[model samples]
Target: MNQQLIAFLAYLSPSLFVITALTSWYQAGLRPTAVKKLGMISSFFGILSSLILAYAVYQQDLIEISTFSIYGLGLSLRLDTVSMLMFSMIAILSFVIMRYSLNYLDGDHRQGTFLGRLAATIVSVQFLVLSGNLAVLLASWILTSLCLHRLLVFYKKRPGAIIAAKKKSIVARLADISLLIGFVLLYQIFGTGNLEIIFQNVREGISPLLATATIFIALAALLKSAQFPTHGWLLEVMETPTPVSSLLHAGLLNAGPFLIIRLAFIMEATSTASTLLIILGAFTAIYGSVVYLTQTSIKTALGYSSIAHMGFSLMVCGLGVYPAAMLHLIAHSFYKAHSFLSSGSVIDLIRAAKVTGAKRIGNPFKIILGILLAIAMYSSFAYLWGVDIQNEFQLFVIGGIIVLGLSRLFSFALDSNASIKLWFQALVLSAVVALAFFSLESIFHFFLMGNVPELTIPSLSEVILMSTVLTLFGLVVFIQIFSPILNQKSSFQALAVHIRNGLYINVVFDRIVRAHYHKEDSNSRIVLEEAEIGKYILDSKENNNEEQEERLA
Candidate 1:
């Protein structure tokens, strides 16, 4: 529990975890069940050690352990609040996924190798998150990417998965290269790779050149986090196993935000960089939300939602709400992971129902669930925007309440027979309305003396305008849901198709890579086949010639 011991354990855990996973992989060939059990055992120990180190870090101000440099890069580990939080989450989630994969990947030929890479990824991510210096961070970042790229392609026999894996590789390598370049630039400008020292110097006043270097670092974070325009790779990454998807998209996806948070701390005094972050974050949030509204596949929908949530976190950071952002990040990781796991179960249920001659009946529970989710999302948005019931923002909040009510009414109309659905809808709606009202009243009291009293209740005309707009948006979504049944094409159908294609961003990238790099010629396969035939003919001719010569002799 001492600081020194914690630092030592933190420094040693990554290598030990990887070694343990590799050993298990070797044993899997002979005893698959035993190997899986070993993996779980190793993960349990790793998590325990990480938690102890986290406790030590909380007791001490900071824990640092320095070892000799490797290849001119200093090997040091630091445990702080941010790093400890990330490490603990990764440890716990990776262990759960490893346990789940035992059942999920049963009887797979490459199960051992897949599990090994998974372990390696967990270690690499922990190292990257805990690294004290840029050199160490960059090394672990690249290692993590490599491990993920391999796991992405574990089902290489599936052509689509292979293609997706290749795309992930390209994006990950680009991110790695960007990170490396940023690190070199930082080192050159700051004359050190230690994050703590650099942050101190930056707080004082970094040079213009170093500020430019910081921009590059920000770019790297944006790409790694799957910000707008660079988010194509993340969508395709769903080809990986469900547990991997849960870990990568829900757990590891936060790495980019973590990096941004770190940078925000370092560059707190830099107005220009902060402004850029705000703009990027706001743009990505809006873009991602628009995309999310149109997705059909549940996982892909969640992917866009993840991007949007991260965007919200980034925006909160931009607004100088670090605690809020961190809170939201933690909240999102749990909820999103649960949603994905539930989605996998839903998929299985649908499959089973199909096999039993049961038509895919609409579950009234789903509608109630969707309405509850909408209310939660609405409240979160309101809270983030500083809305109070007594202020002008209250109009928006009230409008949201009305919308929620209307949505429940629609749910009732759609599923009149489901009493459970009606009860669930009523319960959730009442709770949401009560919470929103209380929050609004509190805000109103805070600004009571201000001139914005009338803002709480918009004029009748204004209410009509705002309500009309929201109703239109809701109507669009509703129509899209029932359009197929109505035998009419809805405008939202086109939007859905576009989002499903990921806005053609990947297609554009594929075109650019193909247009410049040139693919192997289709004729190459034909030529290879012809060459093999020619070789056969030549061997036959030589045999005939030998037979003729022997007869002549």
Candidate 2:
């Protein structure tokens, strides 16, 4: 295989997708059959070309194809391990999504336009991932945001869709501004915008401006990944078509963690920025997870779960475990995409099954046994893998959490089983989960061998932060285990109401944003039903009182 040909194929793949999409939108706008065929053909070429390129890159080590230059910076595309992985993922996922939309929007008039925008979005992300320079990366990032915004407002008449797009636009622009600032700072310090040069400089020595630039980069990532107050946009964007939601949650939203990993060397040099990432990421993780459990709408619940996953990914990057973050990114993308696409069947499944209430079964002995198994399993694996526990305590903690979750799963399965064969099956399932996780991590670690820097001994502050995170993880698990018992008490219902309302955070932000900027059509049917938090709380209390009166009668 010629290396040049391989590189050309890689570029040609996404180019084909873009060209076909534009042609379909422009020429076959009214012909659904023609549009669908073109989409399928384009995606087929994309997957084939990406796979070929990935194989070539793996055989050839790394390839940088420079096309042009401005001042000292080159407009270039690189095919390294990280870029190859991302390119392949984009190709495969786009193919799946495009195939799905053929049936999903079979008769929709604007199906051609939807497919075009979807292809454009994927192409933009591919460019962002393949970028070898800061200038190219920033341009690709902006393009991706614009393409996704068009997909988000597929139904222009829906007020919720419009408002969500508006909110997302505001946050994306803020993120862009932060990224621009970081770029300027890096150029000023390193004297070039080339990523290779910048990274090399980072390895050789730290710059005085690196800390400030890294902080700006982290800020951009936080906004892009929908952290905290800015996350309302993600939840509200559910009015878009299901395929669009799948792409947004699973693909585009991962840019934050990817950006952080791309600059791992810089992050490793700046402890302050890393610490800030830890704090912000930890808070968002816990916040999103809590809200996820309270949602009734399946899509909205999935949105919160995406937030939690992204937050946890960012936290992993902060821990200097960039390989683990990459694995998380890839795994979450596939899982969330499938989850969103198949979410329509959830109601059917639930209606067909028995409505079992949460059981009050808290066995202390089992819990203790599970915790011990987790410790033993993870510790043994770490030892076998020769992981440096003295410096990488964060990895150990994460491994323990993973194993602990699996242990609980096995315990639940065993508790319900009556036969010895069933118990054996549960243990086998637990082992399989552990083995799969380790296998995936090992592959990513191999690809990322040189990317991550060796960590020094943990500082006192980092130790305290890690301890805090462990405590929070334990707290979340404890709540999950015991919340059913507390739910039966009258006093806990108020707390439940607040939790279900997302603690009124999004409600307050929604009102302020809409009051200031939203200009909705008077006759639009889309209403902000969840915006009136106070009314909801009051109504819940009145309903409770009525239920009590009826019971007394």
Candidate 3:
């Protein structure tokens, strides 16, 4: 319960990860089983330390520790509610994923190297979230990218992995420069690099330089989160390893929204930055979601899903709903981790379930009716949850999106049967969604009371933004309800191909990157083939054959 004890506990987990990572590399003579046991032990201690820190922070509002200083910058850590939540997530996921790798990479020649690097990456991200100074935060951010690049190129002979890592490095360098500029501008304006001082200055009033700094930070977040143009690397990196994909998609990609949330106060002051975040994030969300529907590769689909999720998170931050963004971050992390780790079983799972005949396509009028019903359900649930109908236009629109999705899902369920049991199930499902919405909102309101400024009313621009997003999602609902009818047309099929090809966006980038960086015969490094599902299926078949040979021998 003491502040000093909390600080010690806060430092313990990352230190344990770093020490274990170093030992894994140096103690290479140990058997694989012994090395795995060491990893398990280190992970357990890390989780335990994180649990202690979480408890301490829950009891105390916030805890700050300044251990030392280099130059004029203080080496400090701030354990607030948000940072505590992020720390716990990193500790838990690292433990689970490392355990998964024990079997996932059982017989690899460089298993030890992979484990060490994974631990090192985890440590860097943990430090980044907990850092109390801008200098330390920036250094940790860059360190995380470097470690991820190494993991991306773990199979050095694989040309695809090499290309993906190279492209990712370029994007990350751009992000790093943006973040550095933002930090310098902040220090110049506030006359201090300390986060506390900067936040105090932001609270007093926004200076002219603050808005420019916030825009730089927003740009850095967009790049880091793989917004539109920078998302090619994310889709291509699936060649590295499953565990690596799990870590990158589920853990590292979250740093972008985390950065935005960390500076929400400054961002709220700048309407230009907020509007930019809203527009860009909304566009990315729509683009990624559509492309995801077209992709055949499971990892590539998941990559697009990550992009969409991150965009939506940024949009929530732009709307002044910081707590909701945090909730989105934590939920998406766990969901994507499970999705990636279980990706290999997808084919088996699908084969086990037999599909019945498809439902008859609904007419346009019926689909329109479904939309209106969804709006009604959303309104009822929002009222029950005490959502202010007069204000919070963004929240109302978001609730409508969720309800619309649920309606599409239930449309199929209700089409088959008119039974009371099915109807009861649908009602319960809607209630669960409503309950979750309010529960997360309540927790966020309690923990992040003053940190994130409240939105009083929606501006005209915000209203337009809200309408555009709702219309986009509404179109998606309409398409889902009547897909069987639309797919029969030729134009629809042609559009499907383009969407599946990611509208040839990455193709343009591929040529530009190769022309600039690749002097040798780069004929084989075409990025279009990178996201094909067949590539992974072939790789799996080869691995299976090798395992069969080993067993026979």
Report the number of the highest-TM-score candidate. Answer: 3
TM-score of each: 0.71, 0.89, 0.91
Task: Quote the lDDT for 29 in model 1.
Answer: 47
| lDDT value, residue 53 of candidate 1 | 82
Q: Write the per-residue lDDT of candidate 1 for residues 1-553, one digit (tens) a residue.
A: 6656666677565766677577765655433665576668767877887778867865765666667565335977767766776777777777778888887888777677767777788888888878888888888878877877878887764445666666667767777777778778778777887777776677577676666665666666677777777676677767788877887876777877777665554545444544555567656765676688667788888888888777766655544444445556766787787777678787778868845221222455656665665566566656665666444532453346345554544444343444465556655665565465445545433422211112224346534544554454455545533433443447656666776676787679766545223255757755875887899899999999999999999
lDDT agreement of model 2 with the native? 0.81
Show where candidate 1 strays beyond 4 Å: 28-30, 69-73, 350-496, 515-553
Write down the TM-score for model 2: 0.89
lDDT tens readout by residue for model 2, 170-268? 889999999999989999998887887788888899888999999999999999999987888998888889899999988999999989988788788
Show pairs that collide, candidate 1. Answer: 389-440
Q: What residue runs in model 3 are displaced by over 4 Å at the alpha carbon?
A: 27-30, 70-72, 414-427, 515-553
Encode model 3's per-residue lDDT on 1-553: one tens digit a residue. 7767777787776777777678777654324555577678777877898788878777776777888866437678887788878888888898999999988887787787888888889889999999888888899999999999989989876778888998899899999999999989988888776777778788888789988999999999999999987788888998888999999988999999999888777788788888778878878888898899888888899999999998888888777778888888999999999999999898678779896644555465645655565567777767777888568776777677787777775664454434657556766787677678768877987787766677658778778887888788778766767776889999999999999999988878777676135655555544534655568889999999999999999
Give the worst 10-residue stretch by lDDT in candidate 3: 520-529
lDDT winner between 1 and 3, please give it. 3
TM-score of candidate 3 to 2 decimals:
0.91
Name the lDDT value of residue 351 in candidate 2. Answer: 78
